[model samples]
Target: MPSYLEFFAGGGMVRAGLGGRWKCQFANDFDPLKVQVYADNWGEKEILEDDIHKVEAEDLGRRADLAWASFPCQDLSTAGNGLGLGQANGGDRTRSGTFWAFIDLMKELKATGRLPRIVVLENVVGLLTINGGEEFKAVVAALDRLGMRAGAVVVDARHFVPQSRQRVFIIAVSKTAKIADALVRDEPHPTWHPDPLVRAVHKLSGKCREQWMWLNLGAAPELKKTLNKIVKSNPVGVDWHPPAETKRLVGMMSDENRKKLAEAKSSGKRVVGTLSLRMRPSNGRTIQRTEVCFRGLAGCLRTPKGGGSRPRVIVVKGASVRTRLLAPAEAAALMGLKSKYRLPDVYEHAFKVIGDGVAVPVVSFLRGKLLTPLLRSIKKSRAADDSKARRVARGSSERKRRGQLELRV
Candidate 1:
């Protein structure tokens, strides 16, 4: 079975996606709450609930087939201040600087001849343009220094689930490994390679460019679930807003958003959508407004910090419009987690874990389309090379024996 080392394993969503086919050699995360949740579901056999910087190569058993890191994205997310992975501004103390520690671990693994054959880094799409795309170049350059040929693809969770979470997946293969031609293309595909990512690739240094690849995962699958399908009519861990409070929420909507709500109410049939309060500029002043999405998709789930960041659900059936804080169970459903998956009892803790995770189905899609196939080809190539070496060794021994017999004669 293929093995993996998971870094920043929030609730082990990556492991869940990898399923039973892949063996987890090691997993690490710093957050205590997330660690508890991960242990509750996956046990504590391979988990080390500590900082990634303090983790040593010895902590990881054998070299795994793959190393996956979904490092902290606060520094590179649009919701953040765009600090550019700490090399330029904050100097390794920033949240996203955790990526450097991951790189350091990779370096140690390489020095010990335990480097994995494949490495995958998952993060927000802002990594492509943060600090004028310098951070993205630095990441690719780091992989190149480790003797890895790297490529990146932008995958949106909306393709697999109702949430509109877009994440960039950087996939790197060891220079010594043989990659099948079918797994890559000489040029980027329009769907997976957005303009920002293409520009970021073009801006890479010559050495990094030479080592870069255009990974070909082909087209995204059609979305299976819609917003209405995943949301529960009666959700747990939260109560629906009272009629007066729901009216106040509607009163907070701007002209455009109120029109959306009005249209939904007039549809006669039931309409379900997502709502979030955002501050927008109006006549040189910023004002908070409740925006609603009537489409079949939900807004991207975010770690609820303050009141504004939390997303709410809006249901309209004829003239009855109700609003409520999106339930924790509903958020998990949006993330494509099964109903039986264990979550924290606290509402905020459960939402934080769900919001901060990679969508399960998206990881599963990549495993099916790219990871498994690529690993299989590499294993086949290595087996062939080993067989050839044994044959050569046997032939040499036979020739040596014949020479000894001639000498005796």
Candidate 2:
């Protein structure tokens, strides 16, 4: 079996997508809670729980066929309050410096000559434009220096799941490899030729485009599932806001949203879900403003911090309207975790783990459409080369045998 090494392997969501093709030989993460959830699900799977820098690359024993690093993206994410990568105004760089640690690990592996055949990195799309696109150029150029040519695509999770999460995936292969990606943009596949991905590629510097390959997974199927279908709506509810609290929430809505709420009530549609609440200025004072929607797709899951995460989701079916915290199972399903996936008991922990994970079907799509096929092609080419070598060796032996017979005559 082809083996893989995964970094920041939180919750093993990537593993879920890779399916039965790739065996996860080694995994590492720094978060204890995420490791706890991974252990609960994987059950005694060998995991290194120390910081990446502290772990010795030689300790891995065997080199992997593939190496993946999702890397930490909080520093690169736009959702955070700090400057992206927490860099001083074009001077002091802090949080995003964690990415350099991943670089160190890559270098260490190279020094040991155990670096994997294929390298894949995942991070927020912000990396594409952060620091005037300098960060992204550095990433691709770094791969080039390591003797790998890089290809990139920015994909949204909503296509594979019911959540609108967008992330960028960077794929690299050795420059000396004979089999390479098609690197063409005009393939007939549907989801493979996405607009954002095109934009991402176009934005690369001339040098970045030199080794670029277009990874087209083709048109993904139309998602038949909706947010309402996956939801494990609680019958035995928890954290249901009292009527007065509900009234306050309703009152805080913008006039436009309030009109929609009223329309829902008039239409006798009993289901309601509030997306989020934030402070807004109203008549010389700041008050909370709320937003609600009955849309099919859900807002992207956010990491838990204060009350910033898991806003109220209200369900109204008939005479009764119910409001409560979104169930953890529902959150897990949005991440494409079907079964054999375990959730932490605490709501905050559950949200944190799921929020940080890539959607399973999206990863699975890449495996079936892109990674597996590429690996197969490489194997086939290598086998053909070996056969040619054997034929040449046999021909030389025949010539030697004929010369010996002639000498005897």
Candidate 3:
């Protein structure tokens, strides 16, 4: 029943997950490539392919019933652009700026008495730690300035997808109506102390590391996934293996570094400490092995770099496995996108799209568990207001009738 505008609408993942039930009024993204991919699947609605900073809420014609934003996570992601939240990194200029743009739009709506009832925002888990936590406080402060109360939760894609992508979701609701006290608990907010292992993972954004830490990876690592299950078993008839030189170089790391790598590989542990590799400095290759601590879940899929040297699943000989990369479709599934949802691009591009998306099930779960309940409360409060107005009108008319009767007497 809610009408919405999805901002930073990459791959339309948010729309796909929420569109089945909600009425989408508008959506937009800056990337033309992503726009093309979105059109191929969703059939081209009112999607604005412009910088959100340049687009005002009023430009969209009307305020929607709900506003959704899955803004750029590059500034907050350790694995991403790593542009810490600040003015210099275009943190306040690019996608990070989109958050303010959305807020500005909300403010514009408030000016016109048309603010949406609900707002849901999603981002990389690193938002909780970016800029040493000041960036996070700034975000919350912005919401507070708008007279909204927000709640956040870190959701894992593995809950729905085959992969272990995790994201932080912030749901904000205007505090004008009196909501049930039970619905708003006074729980202590989470503090910001960067997890050391997570810091390492961010340095290696190939996978979502925070999730690995939460699982007590030492005790329970990600379950191993065979390349065959993740990729088309016979992709282009190419048996992906490191070149002999690359293999030899990896095997020649410093003795100490080599020992740590071997130990981590054998125990299926995520290597938190950095290691030195034995490759040409220009090649920028590492002998690092994929942390298989928790094989039950797959690491977050990244957009395959067109470069053939992009990382691959390795099947160490005599160790019972073959290594290769997963096709984009499989990566999409890891992001909790339905298998049938077709990507309009080749494998690598599709992987990029999927990697830069919200896990479908994570959003769906939040919609059901958090957003829906807040919406229902808003509905009930509106009904109560309407009912109270009717009673007041009736009471005034009855009082007038009694006055007339007294006059007649």
Per-residue alpha-carbon lDDT of model 3 for 226-252, expressed as tens digits?
323554545542455546643554455
Most accurate candidate by lDDT = 1
Q: What is the C-alpha lDDT of each candidate?
A: 0.90, 0.73, 0.62
Best by TM-score: 1
Using all chains and alpha carbons, the TM-scores for the candidates as numbered come to 0.96, 0.88, 0.74
lDDT of 3: 0.62
Cα RMSD to native, each candidate? Answer: 1.8, 3.3, 8.1
Q: Summarize candidate 1's per-residue lDDT along 1-409 as a digit string, tens digits.
A: 9999999999999999999999999999999999999999999998899999899999998889999999999999877998767772235657888898999999999999999989999999999999999889888888988999898899999998888999999999887788889999989898899999999999999878887889888877899778888777788888899999889888888998999988998889789998888888988999887889988898888888987788899999999999899888888888888888899998889988988899999899889888999899888899999999999999999999999999999
Off by over 4 Å in 3: 59-62, 79-94, 180-232, 235-239, 242-294, 303-311, 315-320
Taking the tens digit of each residue's C-alpha lDDT, what string does model 2 give over 9-98? Answer: 888888888877689888888899888877777654757788876777765658778888887777677665434543213345555655
How good is model 1 by TM-score?
0.96
As for candidate 2, its clashing pairs are 88-92, 189-218, 189-219, 190-218, 190-219, 191-218, 191-219, 270-316, 270-317, 271-316
Ranking by TM-score: 1, 2, 3
